[model samples]
Target chain A: MFTLLLVLLFIPFIGAFVTAPLQQRKADVAAVIMAGAVMLAAISAIIWAGGGRFDYSLAGLPWLTVPFPLFGIQVDPLSSLMLLAITVVGFLIVLYSAGYMSELNKEHPTQAEKDRYYFFTLLFVGAMTGLVLSRNFFQIFLFWELTTLCSWGLISHKRSSVAVQAGFKAMVITAGAGLFFIAALLIMYVKTGSFEFSALGQLPPTLRLTAVIFLLIGAWGKSAQLPFSSWLPTAMEAPTPASAYLHAAAMVKAGVYLTARTIISSQAVPAQAGYLMGGLAVATMFFGLILYFFQDDLKRLLAFSTIAHLGYMFLGMSLGVAGSRLALQGGLLHLINHAFTKTLLFLAVGAISCATGTRSIKALSGLGRKMPVTAAAFIIGALSISGVPPFNIFWSKFFIIAGAIQLNSAWGWTVGLLAIVESLAGFAWFLAVVHRVFFGPASPAAAAAADPPPVMLIPLLVLMVLSLLSPVFGLAIITRIMGG
Target chain B: MYLLNCLWLAFAILLAGSVLCLVSKRHKVNGPLAMISMAAAGLLAVFVAVQVWLNGPVTAGIDSLSIAGFPAVPVFTVDRLSALFLGLIGILSMASVLYTQGYLPHYKSEDPRRYYPPFLLFVLCMMAVVTVADLFYFLFFWEFMTLTSYFLVVYQRDNKKNLEAGFLYFFMTHVTSAGLILVTILFSGWTGSLSFTAIPEIYRQRPPPTRPC
Candidate 1:
């Protein structure tokens, strides 16, 4: 079973390598193959992690062994679930990109950069797979950095000066965090005589505290907590697929995963760490939601909302193990839900941008009449992200708020209240965006624009349906994985 | 023994390739050549790293290979952590290099060879810094990595913002390196050895000093 998990991680990388030499004309074919590989990998990972019987292994070469201890990879319950989330969402986004990018390519004929886009997209999926399945911190960090590099490429894909600047900012901020991460690992090695995560997990109290704090800094940067939150909004300069990838599915989730891993592994770390995490999470949530109210760009508003939602995940994970167990499960489940819902919204936005040639909220109006299907998908996604009932995000946010209230601490109560306030603020903002863009008098562009091609619209519909169905599957996974 | 040879070979190839690309007249081939050499080196490093990751840290030394009183230091130690970083470097460099194949055309009019190869070399140097176990080797690679990347960042010297970003990045990374090196030196002095493997046991037996440094 663990071996199946390991294989799942490498499948995308293999797919990427196989498709790399394919000509630019073969971009769609390559993308489909890559997406299919990811989907199969996701299915296998879910089944294996769901307690199904499966096992396989490739033996290490005997001659290369230097009599040193080697750490083999494992796919336990946690990794299997994460891999499943990454692949399912990643595959859908790739499918969505096929139609969305082609439309953009046609509109800007000189911008026929299909090869570069597909290559990096495949690379990103593969790297993300490696990140989730690796049992060792080293492997995780390797994949983590790969995701960073891949993201920089994606963010700068538009090649505009603004996009380039945003990419550079992201690189520096994340790379700076990477340095702190390296320092933490080095210190852990210096103290424990090993870099293996299992070894570090057994460390004494003081060492554990230091490692945990170091890990938190890395998470904070990657996840866009507090001071690091600015870059995520800037990342909206990327294409909608890239934005969805970074915000909902892969990159930001790395931070949540790191925090969860550290807290779970270091069981004896002081309660102070939890308190600190909770405080930061609460602060970031309110700050993000407050900022979201001021944004006029549709994507930027979503980006800020992403920050607020990330805060909920962080806060949930910080309330100690008992509190965090449910919180972390909720957080992870939210990540999966966000991937579908956000991608749906972004695809719809991309379609809207194509037809209207504008992203400004004020300039666009009454798109529902022209692009009815897209408008409906966008509404579904918007409602789900706002935590409306029966949607997957609502369930996860509910669990997080309930977890906070159960903590019975002043900070927890404050966080719970803030969660409600932030949700209301988010809902209000969404209503404003949707109402202004979809219901009011038709703008000049809306009157002339037609629906996007079915290639694009179908993916949006699939995602909308998935978003609606995700809650039931998510609840079952959470209960099984977390024993909630 | 083979690990030391492999480390030296990889470093020599990287140094030669970077220098060639920096000085070469034919700019068109420079990026590809540098990428190939790096890919070779990175692949070897990954092989060594995976071994370390799966088994344990591999340690080796070519003692007294240098004439100076200082011992001929170990050049490479593939511990589990280093292996992880090595894999990251391999994967990232591979993608960055491939992307550069398409991206360099945008900069071809401005000496593509000089712009791209140095960056690849810089990435290689960063990978080396993460894997080297000895303090001297670590610092050497660390400084080299910073210098190469600094040049790459400022490759667009005509742009004032580019130069400013480069300088800022240089200053920040140097400051970080200073802090890291200071800690390394303190650890070395405390343990009376530069080998990272020795420090953990030493620190375990003797609690760290009043202040970490």
Candidate 2:
């Protein structure tokens, strides 16, 4: 088990170094294989655990033990589930890029930077996997900062003036917010003499509240939940697959996962802290939903959708901290479900641009007949994201709403009611976009468009079925988690 | 175990046919292979599902391969719920694979490699997902079914958009699968076993939460 954990952790880092020197073709193949290997190792770890937890730490990490066991791995059901999502999604993205970054690509037709793209992408995957498995605050922080570095590299992969500025802006905001994370770590260490996640529970009342607030700021920034939300949309300047991975599966998820993990590890978190989180999260959710009306670019619209979904997660987590296990389960499930849905939306847009040479909702129409697979995939994604039934998000969102109602307070009712309003409004807007872009009569751009290659279509079809079936498994897991 | 025998036989035919599809160079040959395998499997699935529906559940134990650490675990148990889903899979798999026979002629530029193999494997996985009694194997086949369908969705490799669509499709499915997997673990943790057989006894012993309403 320990050996498998080590392999899972090191394989991507090894791939990053190995792929850096290889030519483009070799690098792409190697990176995909490497990601595939990481995914296999993660699965092996799951089988090895056999429904139990594994906590493996090196006894001889002498210098690294200043405040914590920074070099250990903790593979509970939570971390294992996260590891699977990260590695599996990472592998698919790399496979997609093998075709997506080629000269055949109509959206951005150049094979100029495959090595760099694979290098940073692999590093980002590694960092996310590591972050999920980290047993201590310092370890999580290291992986956390590594993710910020990788996003900077990936977001600016094209190095256009706009891309560079967007990348710089993302780095400045996230890394700046990361300072508060480390500061919180410092506070925990000073007050409790440990950097274990549980140390937050040991801090005195005043400092504990302060640390929680500081951590929330870090989560907000990384997740791009309002006030820190601006960078995500601009970060859309990155290549589509990178946007899909970073925004959907990796970077943004890191924020909420951290918050959820912290809450899970700590005890007796204050009611006020939960209220602050719930309040900011609801505001962010509403704020993101309102901005959906303004987006012309498909990616920007999806970006706002991501922001709103992240807010949903924060709301769920806050409710969990306030004593609703169902909400926590739903929040975690949403993290996984939204990754697939939002990534599908982003990549669908990528496919649109690849075929039609434009992502402008106003510039494209009647693409359904031409690009049937993409159109179908997009429709599924849109409906699923808007909380339609039998799709993935609907189930998680249902639990979250139920959780709010279960809270049964004035605050809960208000947030639950507002969430319902947001869901309906989001459905309306997404359906509008779908009708205009896919269902209308063909414009010139749509006339020339068609479904993508077998390489790309495979992932979309797989995701479509996943969207449909996710509720079955999502409910089972959440039910068991809540002991229902 | 007669139904179980038919199920295993169908699985073998599909697996063998898919391997042939991958290796065969001629589209004409691949089409017939896919059609034959899918038809045989679909008939078997429907027959087994009907048998289970009429005569109660079908149960079988694979002496060779049990879920790891749980040696007595049954590998195939088709209860009514599984039978219903299996029947659906049978109909859909037959219809889609048969449809592809007519569909393949239009895409002259495409390779048969992209479609027939994945289609067969997709069917096989779907069949396995419903038939497997262990939660782990159910999820494993469920995920495999998702993975194989991806190849079918992106049959047009030249259109970059299809590739993007495929990626998006895959990203969503793969991630959601992690949920079912987690549920399986939780089930095992609670029941001390990985088979569906353990579920009823555990639930009987411990009552489920009452719905608030």
Candidate 3:
């Protein structure tokens, strides 16, 4: 089973190696094949993980080991869930890209450009896979930086000046944040003589707090939380699939994943620390909502919404520290639900924009008629995200509130109040969006628009229906994730 | 326990009556539905108040549902303090819902049924805030109350001034809610418990959290 994990993590890297040299049109086909392979590997890994936890260190392999001998991989219910999400969503985005890249920026893309795009996309798949499976923070950070590089590459693939700038901003912000994470890891190494997560408890209380603060800085930067979140909206200048693939599905989740792993593995989380995290989360969520209200660009609006939901996840995870297992479950579940909902939204919007040649909410209306399938996917995504009941995001949001209600602390109540306000605001915002953009008479651009090919629609439909039904399955997985 | 059950019964009646208002095609049916629900809730509120006044603060709470060993907020906590407010609000709500029978024609909105949801939501949040024992739930319901009021104000956003008023109303309520949040935070910090019942013990302590920081 451990060897199965290794194979799953390496499969995408091998695919990228084989994919990079292929010709343009063939590369798209090859990439889809690779994506299918990756998805299958992830499903198998999920099954293998259910039997038991896996903690395999590369330290025994003399040639494969890093200088610090801290390279390794691990899997639990949480990692398995992340693996399932990244690969499944990753494959869909790649398949969508196959249809999407047909006409790039008004010109048919060259073979070299297509190959290059798939190369980086496939590399991202492998790196994110290795990232979640890796046990050691050192290996995780290495894979983490690899993903940043991959996203930067994909974001700039169009070679437009705006694309270049967006890529640069993403790289600079995430790498800068990564520096804080590295510093925290270094401090842990100095204190405990090890870089593994299990050694995180050896530090004294003050050092533990210091490491937590720095780790949170890194997480916030990576996740595009407030104050460091501007890069995410700008990164929307990339192709929509890239935005869906990197920003929504894979890279952005790394932050919350790190935060969850950190708090859960730590010896004990002090109450005041939970308060500190809760306060940051509230501020971040507020910023995300305020940003969301003003976004004219569709992707940027999704970006702001993404940032806001990241804060909600952190808030739940923080409450988890105060001994609210419901919060932990909700936070993790939200993380997964956001991944699916957000990616579906981005991909559907991407298809709409590709067909209509516009991504502005104002420029596009009455799309529900001609592009009913895409419209349905978009509406479902929006409703799920806004915490509407009978939708996937709603259950997680409810559980998060339940966690806050359980916390019953001053910090808990404050977060609970803000969560309610934000959820209500989201409901109104997305509902108004649906009414304006989809329900009204078709604008000229929307009138000319057609639904995306079945290649894209199938994935969207599958994800939409699966997400709608996820709440029932989520209960069992959440309990398993809590390590019971 | 009987007092608590009576209070819950009143809540159920009000909520059920609000849902029943949806079935009516005419104002005649809906207005009386509203009145009946409010009147039933008011009667129950009066009963709760009398019981609390005579018994000197009877508390009823449930602690069965928890997360990670942290107990959940009590479903409802109706001591003398909360019971008094519930009774007063119930009386006010009954009068207001009755007044809506005649006043329904004056408000310039189609489907006057829209008013009742936010109105009932407002009343429910108010009752919930007072009746909740823990600080967390109190703040949550406080914000809910504030939000429902904002919605009610903006429901008639036919004019620029109405929108402006809604915005201002939202801003002011959040400021007050922020203050309430801060107060609860400081109270929990000093008292080490968020239960309203613990305030007296904190105040009676020898030092009484004298640092004030």
Docking class of 3: incorrect
Interface RMSD of the candidates, in order: 25.2, 12.7, 7.9
Clash count (model 3, backbone only): 1
Docking class of 2: incorrect
**Model 3 alpha-carbon drift over 4 Å, by segment:** A60-69, A104-112, B1-213
lDDT of each: 0.70, 0.81, 0.77
True contacts kept of each: 0.00, 0.00, 0.00
TM-score of chain A of each: 0.92, 0.97, 0.95
Which one wins by lDDT: 2 or 3? 2
Per-model TM-score on C-alpha atoms: 0.66, 0.72, 0.70
What TM-score is obtained for chain B in each of the predicted models? Answer: 0.82, 0.88, 0.81
Q: What is the full ranking by lDDT, best candidate first? A: 2, 3, 1
lDDT of 1 at A352: 82
Estimate, for each residue in A291-407, the C-alpha lDDT of model 2 and write its tens digit. Answer: 999999999999889999999999998898877666777788898888777777777888889888889999888787688779879988997897764478865775677567666
Put down candidate 2 lDDT per residue, B1-213, tens digits, no spaces.
889999999899898889888777578888988898899989999999999999998788786544222222548989899999999999898898888789888898677866888788888888887778887667657766765776677677555577567656765675565456446545665676778778887778896888998
